[model samples]
Target: MENAPLPSKPHYAILDGLRGVAAVLVVIFHLFEAHATSHLDQIINHGYLAVDFFFLLSGFVIGYAYDDRWQKMSIGEFFKRRLVRLQPMVVMGMIVGAAFFYFQASKLFPMIAEVPVWKMLLVMLIGFTLLPLPPSLDIRGWQEMHPLDGPGWSLFFEYVANILYALFVRKFSNTALAVLVFLSACFLIHLTITGPNGDVIGGWSLTPEQLHVGFARVLYPFFAGLLLCRTIKLTRVNNAFLYCSLLILAVFAMPRIGGADRLWLNGLYESFSIIFVFPLIVFLGASGAVKSNFSARVCKFFGDISYPIYITHYPLIYTYTAWVQDNKIPIREAFPVALLVLASSVALAYACLKLYDEPVRRWLQKKLGPAKVYQKA
Candidate 1:
């Protein structure tokens, strides 16, 4: 009976909608990224913060979904559940990236054409496992861990956070967890403030510095989110979905806080947002009820495609970025193409969600032994 499937829980629909919102912002951010020479000039300046927001959401969702099932569920089972949820999309993202690999060759990606088929396939195979490729294996000239799908870096850290939760952090008392969160918050603050970029903008590579950035970025938000789940007293908040969605957009759409000379100021702003604004948003999201059938449907639709869009959109962005760079088209003239890429990415993500991710996950769960009936938070 210990291995029996647990019943799934209801989702926080508003949180799911917010996640979809953030994922969309991340896509727009990446599109703008192709044009910006520096972070300051980037149009959606704080869009990178969306990753941090995701970590927060993940932490909250994981806690809400799993914190109480440990007596009945083994660590191995917990991992299997996570794998079923995440690994399918990871593989799809890598496959999508591999399929688009050759077409992305341009001045922006000089190494794409030089990369051999065998090497590219090898990378794709490695990517299926979500293992971080060392710089030596960087096929696309960018020093991304998963060069095929760059955003897989966050997923990698996400797995690390999960491992820590399963092995150690999940057992920590609220007080202990609070201490850890405090120290992690301090580390996050220091890393963001003192960094050359004056922002929490890295964690894609395998080097010591990037790894430090990644850990700092993941630890605080993820654990803070977990801590919030354990301690939060959710109050009834009216119109939480609407209010939280707008707040998230406003945060991501914010301008760079400080320019080159005052990087610490930007760091402080980021720190404040992660430490305060994000958790508040999560609390509100969780507290708010999905009152209307229309609102419920909207939340469900966004929630359904959120992960698919996030995991799968970057490959398309790579192609779009290449098209812009190869043609030497100005961002102003390239606006139409950018819009097309955005719409196409949305279409592609929804298609993958329906055609591949859901089917593959359903198959995996059935074959993998006792299906853990966890919430789709």
Candidate 2:
């Protein structure tokens, strides 16, 4: 009975709502990203920080979900649970990218026309495994690890974080975890402030520099989230969903600080947000209650679709980006079309959630049997 799986605990609904909010902002950021010349000039400038926010959220959730269950759960079982939760969307995201692969061909993706169908399928297969592709295998000129879906790179690193947590970090004392989080924060600050771009972007590629950026970006937020879950005492907050959602938006939409001459200032802002602001938001969100029926429903809906939208929306973004680049369309001219793309992406994500993701996960869980479940703390 110790090894038998248990029922799922109730979720922190407001946190789910916040995740959906950040995901939607990511879509808008990418839409605006298609128009920007560089990281410094990009509109919705801080949108990339959403990835860090996500890492933090993931760490906290993982801690909440699994920390108590380890006594009953083996590491292998833990991996099985995570795979069941995350892998389905990973597969679907890649397929969506492949389905829209050729449609994205344009001056921006010069290599698409040259890529054979078999090769594209091959890339999709590799993407299915969530393995980072070497630059030589890059079918798209963008040199992304998963060209089929750019955001898949984050999922790859996400898997890395999960592996670390399950294998080792899960056993750390609260003090040790805090120390690790501190060191990670220092590394993140150093990397962000000293980097050529002065931002925590460029973790999608498999290059050494990008890999460094990837590790730097992931470690602090993820472990800090874990540390947070371990140490913090929750207090009830009013309108946690509303307040946290607004904070996420404000952070992601904040303009680039200090401009080109003061790149480190922008880095400092990003560091402060991840280290201080995000944890506060998560804590507040966890402390919040969904008292109103309307608020509960909103949180439920957003929470349900958050991962679906985050994982699957980028293929449409690829097409929209191609259109913008090929025609050199300005943001004003492309606003209507961008809105349509956002709508379509949302629709696609909801459809995937209902038709594909939910059904598939149920089937897999049924087949795999339950691993472990913890009661709400």
Candidate 3:
């Protein structure tokens, strides 16, 4: 107790605000999923950037939550805390996803008539393991997994980032500076090098070490966000950072970043994004500053349910879309229906939190105790 790294209580409102933004981003992205599939890919394709924001935001939160505490607890405690937070929803989501797939399968081939029993079950297995998800060929070139949202990929990474952060980031004395330098360097190196997937490699370049570079580039922000936990405690984030996060968020809507164009610019926008958005969020929340200014109540509201909003929105997207297609509503007409799906998802998720998520989280603390993270001996 006396030996804890630092006695600190984070501003929970920041987390709430972050979750609010993440949920909205995911919602906006889901809107694109609807538009793209129903009839809009040709017009716009960068909706998936919501996943990036989620990952970045996740990194920031983890840093805020456990950066200091990482040194105080045993590795077992860290994992138990994570399991308590993650496993219930994860397992439940998997089961629900499988059931939805089966339900649709029943109608399609109608399980009684033609479900490849093994294959149907296998798809769920793959999904739960975080393997490849089925793509909607009927949609654009982009693939869709029926009965589930596409952004689950980031959740997997969030788990990974948290573990890695606990291991590396939590061990540092000067963590903020170290992570900032390390993460920023890795990001730069990634853009310089090309990937087997074909990033760019020319005048200003590094090595084509895809796995290393990509891992570093993707993770550094989370690490940076962890570092941000420390930085935000001292200095107010620059106003430019906020404007920048919003700007890059706009860029996040572009597909070229995922395409051949990424060769020259893949990591650029993310770097810019973290530089601007992360700090802006930290600054705004920490200093009580606002740009165009939404009401504090609204901001606080979104912040409150951001986690449930993050966890529960996807299933609604799938169930709603499936209903749309089966019922034969046109995309233009279906936007309202889809919006209903989005709102309902948020509401249902929020209700579940009141009824379940919050109580469960608290129970986890009582049973598992306060979440902890530290280096493994």
Candidate 4:
């Protein structure tokens, strides 16, 4: 009886383009990350903030899509829809990471070459379930919860946010939601300001410390974005796409706020950016329209490939980083290959979307029968 007649709202097309832009920046960030010794000198310095932006976007989109539909949708049905939309790429990402593991042999992770094939396969199998593995089982020395694919760690927390929403957060009234978000923001501010690194940078590993950082990273922006959705009004803007896109880049491109002596300055910058700036970008993106066919197509293409690219591209980064380290080549010298890796990552994401993810989701939707689909328009 639930999910019988709920009509899905149209997606914010500019926001989709913005997501693609952020994802691409992340790839660039990682590429430069291969050459840097520390976060301060990382070329695309603030790119890691993309994850926080993603969490904010997720909250906003989820609130837009699901808040009013709860009367017609059950928790089980909500989980099913999310799984259908997200799980396919997750599976494919693990597979791709596994297939490319051997190719990533380098000094950064020298043990990668010696990791037995069976152990790699085992790690891949565990990865497919979106579960975290302990340090003893970390095939890659990086200590990522999902050793096969480093980015899977964020996906893992994403699942947590969804579960929390389905069971608890969705029940809060607007006032209550705002209060929760404010409290979470306070906690996040504390974590970022007092931390040794002066950034919200952990959460990949299985350590207790990283787990704390992960939660700190996810809690506020997600709920705040949701609250923003429920409260703010959208107003029309000219060149909204360009402006929002540039603003996002500026946010991530921001330099470390202070030198090493005043680490909290950087943390303040990060906290303010996440708390105030990202939501404004989303609001602007949602408020505007794609006025031309070219922009529309670009946004559509990017939106279509963004998730696949994000979930699948890091293995290529691992390989590229390894290659760079193995050869003692500066990223400057390796620039051409980095370009190749970028192109290949995009092409591969497109291929997997056409060949696997779309087909599989379609099949799942068909077999699962009629249900609500909150697709981006």
TM-scores, one per candidate: 0.98, 0.97, 0.68, 0.97
- The models' CA-based lDDT, in order, is 0.92, 0.90, 0.52, 0.88
Least accurate 10 contiguous residues by lDDT in model 1: 368-377
> Judged by lDDT against the true structure, how good is candidate 4?
0.88
| C-alpha RMSD values across all candidates | 1.1, 1.6, 7.2, 1.4
Which of the two candidates, 1 or 4, achieves a greater TM-score against the reference? 1
Candidate 2, which segments miss by more than 4 Å at Cα? 1-3, 371-377
Tens digit of lDDT per residue, candidate 3, span 41-113? 3233444444444555556666666655645666666667666666555544555555555444322223323
Candidate 4, residues 1-377: lDDT per residue as tens digits?
A: 44364576788889888888898888888988888777877777899999999999999888998998888878888887888888899999999999998888778788898999999999998998899999999988988899888999998998899899889999999988989999999989999899998999989988999999999888998898889899999999889988988998898888777978889999999999999999999999999999899999999888888888899999999988887777788877999998998889899989999999989988987776545556631
| Model 2 lowest lDDT segment of ten | 368-377
lDDT of 4 at 222: 85
Query: Could you tell me the TM-score of candidate 2?
Result: 0.97
Q: Clashing residue pairs in candidate 4, if any?
A: none
Best candidate according to TM-score:
1
Which regions in candidate 4 have their CA more than 4 angstroms from the true location? 2-5
Clashing pairs in 1: none
Q: What is the alpha-carbon lDDT of model 1 when measured against the actual structure?
A: 0.92
User: What is residue 74's positional error in candidate 2, in angstroms?
Assistant: 0.7
